[model samples]
Target: MMKLEGALYPWRFRVVLGLLGLMVAAICWRIIDLQVLDHAFLQGQGDARSVRHVPIPAHRGLITDRNGEPLAVSTPVTTLWANGKELQAGKDRWSALAAALGQEPKAFAARLEENAGREFMYLVRGLTPEQGQSVLDLKVPGVYSIEEFRRFYPAGEVTAHVVGFTDIDDHGREGVELAFDQWLSGVPGKREVLKDRRGRLIKDVQVTRNAKAGKALALSIDLRLQYLAHRELRNVVTEFGAKGASLVMLDVKTGEVLAMVNQPTYNPNNRRNLQPAMMRNRAMIDVFEPGSTVKPFSMSAALESGRWKPTDTVDVYPGTLQIGKYTIRDVSKNEGVLDLTGILIKSSNVGISKIAFDIGAEPIYNVMQQVGLGQDTGLGFPGERVGNLPNHRIWPKAETATLAYGYGLSVTAIQLAHAYAVLANNGRSIPMTMTRADGRVQDGVQVIPEATAKTIQGMLQQVVEAPTGVFRAKVPAYHVGGKSGTARKATVGTKGYTANAYRSLFAGFAPISNPRIAMVVVVDEPSTGAYFGGLISAPVFGKVMAGALRLMNIAPDNLTPADVQPAVAVTIPRGLAR
Candidate 1:
């Protein structure tokens, strides 16, 4: 069987050897391709499977008052997360994690079961440093944590209205927070995370972009002044048994708001007990028919328009002035003639009504509009209201007349204060602001001529200085100047004013020699025997003004009272009596 031709045997052996050589060459080519050409791609796939993105929370910015007092800040904390897939692989691992986190094992197991197959899941958020350490000590597989921040308010309820509060993600929600939210929310950063086979974060692989914190916001509020105003206003509210109260202090030099306070305020740190009404900033939002506070504007407009003089006398009927179908009456009986200054000192509704008719609505409306009434002050707020102003075109005969005596129009406390500040600044109506910027007046648009403004200022001073006028507001050492207003509260169902409930307002500028601080105090529905501005709110004005001036280190106009004497007892005309 082995005896075959030599040529045939050799040919068959050569064929078999050639086929083996081809097979070996093919194997070598495959090995070279796999080892060299495809290595980078395989490596890239492995990296993708293991890599992750870990968010590094940036620190929130600080909020400080103008005096550099920290109002809001961020405290460092930790957030715990888990790898659902890895936790499932480790039996009872969830129970261990929950035990270390002080959570119930049953709840932890249920939560993990619900989130099975999830790549990443949060176990707990906002962990304290101590809690974080406990979690780290457990060394439980799949559990990871990273640093974060939580906002805090140092001043709490006292500064809540001004500093406002931020959301869980550190976004502003109210007050300065909302006004400057974009500036307060810093950009979050990202880093590459190294993960194990089961998508558990091992460590940060590389930082792609560093987190940038928000900018610190400096407010114009003075903490001391704010505290003072809050204390006194709260005292008065409790004394009068009022439902609530509001107080605001403005820098006369510029329309800067130094202190704005509202009662029933809520602490930003614990808002669970907050009331809806407590959150409203009444100084800027509440509108009332400024009562006698508006008399100065009327008297000023009349004197400025070259229509009346301080001594110019107008006959006021004993009881009422008949206009169209409505008869406008005074609070007290004054059957005689009253000069321009006398009308303001007496707060005669009938006298003011005659003057409003004399000046007409156009000029007064124009001046009021120019002085920032019936308009927004451009303050950064959520819901600022524009007070109502009766258009001259729509003003009926009675409406125009009533508007002169501080009726048929409405204004917020801030607007009244701003108008008084304009009078203090010698006729220039400066724009009001919340931020503590430059204190220089904005060269206010001169609504009334300088002469008219000065005259009104002199009359307003007399209202406080005169003996019979309403001397309840005079400070012992300071040269006080201001006006008192008592407008009846509007009845809900009917049209006429309520007899018992009245909005008492006293607005003025102090240190008449050189006005430093302007203030307006309005007490709504005061239950005390006296609801008139002169009796109720004017004294508060005097108290607050004296306190504010003393705090600001302003010298008194008269060290002693012999330099000035109580003028003639300018009894409030019977018609103007409330």
Candidate 2:
């Protein structure tokens, strides 16, 4: 019995020892992993949990008209997001989400089933507060919202071109939006939130960075003038059956862009049906051969160079002047030895061409170039064409003659108005500006002699006052002066030009005696009875100027003319002479 007891004891002891050995081995293995093998991995997990990240978008700035009227403003909106894993675990998820968010069930289901392995997904953008509350009320797990800004244009399509539009991300897309995007787009701020072990939010850990708001921009454009310009331009476009039209009103002394309007415009807010063509701002973007309107430049060039006086007569034959293969003629039958003033009054193409040949192409090109023709005005608008000006070498004899009368070359409405403003402002050429950055007026360079500018101003006055030009473009309160331009439109599919289709242009400034403002009006392809610039564009110019004058509070210069009355005495003796 003693021997049996000893053997059993030995067996029990070996079994107990084996169990202890196994326990020690397991503990050692775990210690090695915790101390060495898995140490780096565990460290990384901790660091990731402690560190937080958030997005920052620069808030865009405010855009206001000259009168401090808000044209564009940014309003806060909610963007919906979802945690895929959490959302998938929710009961009756798809139907609840669709009902809460006002989306189709099928679409919402498809979105959930999408295989983007991301933990988060965007459900929708630009949500109203009500929509956000509805989603939160659904109690669907993992769905959340973030705040963002959506731009709003108060004046709508009326100022579409001037105000421009921004993208979904609040980036400026076109017009003033693009021009001042950098200055206006503010920096964004961010914060980190701490979450408990079960992924429940604790509190905002810290504000990582503070976001900066964008700068506000104030334009030199007057909202009232802009409205007026739009009204007149729209009416003319309807009445004339024209394809499109543009108008620019400028401050002669300051070179401020008071008003610019383009027809065929679309609402910046509703961009679903926007056409690429309609999106363009034609005043600065497009250029055309400015027919008779250019004749003044030819005359100005001659007068500036002292080659001809305003009274100097050119024996312009009854009609056409044959140059190489081209024949240029007077638009009117009343042609003779015309003085420089008469040439412009009748819009004599032949007379101007003769003077251009006398002055020579090189000299004329130089003069035109100096006066801002065929040059970019640097208005900061995208896609501005410098227009077409043939080099001295390629200028055919006919080319020179044609260009002399505002053909064979092209100029923008902005460029034309700026050039005309030089005459209105006494020969000083100021840079065209949309912003009032440094001051309202910038120093101007003298392009034409003061005397020469005055002479041209006096001559252009006849274009409004003469019987032939009496279409009601005349301003009774101010001595206004400017010329009209009519150019044939080029065919779209071919290089050939058409006679009936014309781009009518009127470039002038008012209170001409002591001019304060300059403007340019261009109507493209008017199909109505009135196609001439003098007929279609001039009356609009007159109306716009009258309104602007009253707005500026510039008292009437021609009070005598306004107040004058005829003596009304009877002529007694003259009837019997026959």
Candidate 3:
């Protein structure tokens, strides 16, 4: 019995040893497969469990004005995110997390429940570093904060319409922001990271893609001029009790937009109550009939036709003229022969209409087209309107007569400013730009002979210089020449025109001897009894232009003593005069 028991025990031991050897072989195979044969697969599975491919955000570019002053900039901020499942798992930490996040515990839990399906969700965005660090110090599981950039506009609402604002994703939304979004937005990068079981990043393994920072953008806007324009436009809009107002100032030599401001502006930084209508850049996007502002172009056309001379006279008998069924009349009675200069000085629609009809529609249309009417300003501004100017072929005599006096057509404030720039630049049309000039002079298309431009400039000078002229546009030490226009706002949907609503506009240039700035101001639907362009719009032009000219160090042309009552208080200085 002892021998049988020993043999059985030995057989049992052998069986146990064989089973143990098979188990060891299987373990060895698994180790070999994991460490060598299927190493990459095992490593990948391990990485999938703890290591993550994370995104590294790149910084957005800076936006600066022509003077290199920051207009729009990106500041580093913290965005709080959470792994919903893990965050909700820590019931004890919920109150602490809610306290750190400035939320009620129950409400915070409800928010988490609402997003329970989302593994990753934002708890807060654009928190200050101090605030984010405070949350981080709470050591809440599954909660994390990432470094990101938030756009800021230093100029605030002063440059709101021009610089625009960015979305929460750091994408540009309006104005220059939207226009150069691709140039301003950067490409993100990727990296491998080791995360703890609670989803906190423990280590960065290696970078898979390097982030490219966005390129900086330099705009042509002068913030100083921008502020000045804003202040003046806002003041005028308030004083006139107008619905809104827009002003544009251009660098006549460079075609750079020195300043552009619109009243009823919104703060780009505080966008909580943003209304899309208030955010619109009316100067670039809205169009109006231009009223007598178009008369300058008509006079230019008349001069270009080789039929009218600056000194020639037009008899505006009874101050009214009938063309087909339409009757054009002067606002005030000056029922007598008036020279071209006198016609402009008095803003005589009848006299100007006579000149336009005599000159023929083709020449008038050609000149208007040359000065950039009925066309886009080529600024590429988002939502910019190409003001309506119908083809001359469709014009009846009545429409032609109305067209001659700044009716039957529409123009944006930017376009009106551009047209005045044409006259300021010696009848040369230069493409406008919102970017800084690089010392390369742009060649302009000669739309009118320099002599003709000079003649019209002299006539416009009379309008601002004559005692009965647009004296409201006169600057203290500078010669300013511009035209004013008041037109009934065309009624929406259907329209002959709104009897009560009028668009008051003034467009002109300053330092007449050497024009440096061209500006336009439009006050929409002024409620004040005095809705005349000379009253409501001209003063805005004067104030903004005077400040801009002085800021630019432009030499004042009319340096006559303030006390002296010269024959002409301000004249187009002889060197530039015809």
Candidate 4:
């Protein structure tokens, strides 16, 4: 073998050796460039695909009732997102992803086409933990899930108008949510994270910024009272076949809204086919001619004037009065004169009109304004209506007469409740609030004399005590003071009031001996059967007040009550009756 040919064979071996040497030299040069010359650049390139600044979600505030019962709260949820660029390689697996998202394959494919150009895309939002985990188990490239919040209303439609709701992105959209968005939505934080090529989170590197949780809001509603009112109002509306209805109860001492409920309400949790009308807080937003509910205010004005007395009477002979083109009439045709208390109990529009003309409009106007009619309640509700009250020192006989009997002027259910509160609070106009006061909050402005309020309370009690009065409004063992109103609805896009359509209302306070609560019930356009305040609305007031009184632990005042009196009290005045 040593003696073999040394010509072509030796040259071939030399060629192989030279090639190996060149390969070793090239490896050394590459090592120098990576370790010294371009080290920072190479390391940065490696990190570019892995390092990420991720958002750390912050929770929204809790909205609770005055008794610490949760009305609205934010629960942790998951929102799935995708890195569109990375997901392109896994297009074939999209059908599986779409199935997890509860989407049709063709629909999901079409959506992908629209979002293909984007670097990131939202896949599904507001998913439960199990729902989100099911999709993530697929391990599809570029798919990720982030924690978020979904608002939940515990009281459902019962507290819908007051608690409101948020959008998919956790933004407050209505009710108290819209009113206090800034205070309820806190700042989101950020963190440094390491992710794999598929956009899957590998590790949390460090917290870049800490998240700030939202502030908790305590509302003025009492959950027990709210539930009671909601149940009673819904039952009445359904049974009466009413177009709409509203009920508001107030803590006369604190001026706090204890319970406010509306019929045809929408559940904030599931607002898929919600109508705009269903979302209105009708207790404060919808305005109507209060009908005879405002007669209490007229009576307040009468008592405050010193020109009229409880024993005074008005002539309602034919039960109808001709004031210009308008004809005011009582529900029943009367043959004799009536006292002030009798006029209110019978809801005599003719009798009330005579009193208004006798006293002039100024006194009635002043008392109505003082008791929060024709003005906003100052509660700052989103779509609250201020109502209408014409303030003219010189009034037409028609306008003044209509004002006395609860027409020509407009008011909201809450406004009527507030006015009754002034009477319940011993003639003081307390500042109405939707938020709970700390302790012993006494905010009041005098709207009438204490003696006048007490006297009116006694007179109102007679309205519920008389056999022809609102027998339905009388709580079993409570001294209820209430007024009934049956107002003809103004024809839509017309001037005159409609005959068949009516707004039934009953505003009253319980435990007249020591008034602590005032409530108003309004049923609009009762479609079937009775539409009078004494029939539909007064029954709701009685039912709700019965439950509310017991739940609030308030003592009943009618411990030693008198028998039901005769309807007609024929006390004649010197010149006022007729």
> What clash count goes with each model?
10, 3, 0, 0
RMSD of 3: 7.4
Taking the tens digit of each residue's C-alpha lDDT, what string does model 1 give over 77-168? 88888878777777656677778778899887988888888878988877788989788787777777878898889988887777778876
Model 2: ten consecutive residues of lowest lDDT: 1-10
Superposed Cα deviation of residue 172, candidate 4 (Å): 1.2
TM-score of each: 0.84, 0.87, 0.90, 0.87
Clashing pairs in 4: none
- Top lDDT model: 4
lDDT of 1 at 377: 78
Which scores higher on TM-score, 3 or 4? Answer: 3
For candidate 4, give the lDDT of residue 473.
92
Give stretches of model 1 more than 4 Å off.
1-44, 81-127, 135-143, 197-199, 333-335, 438-441, 491-499, 561-578
Model 2 Cα shift for residue 266 (angstroms): 1.2
Reference-based lDDT, each prediction: 0.79, 0.83, 0.87, 0.88
RMSD values for the candidates in order, in angstroms, are 9.8, 8.8, 7.4, 11.7
| Ranking, lDDT, top scorer first | 4, 3, 2, 1
Please tell me which model should have the higher TM-score, number 1 or number 4: 4
lDDT of 3: 0.87
For model 2, what is the alpha-carbon lDDT of residue 94?
A: 75
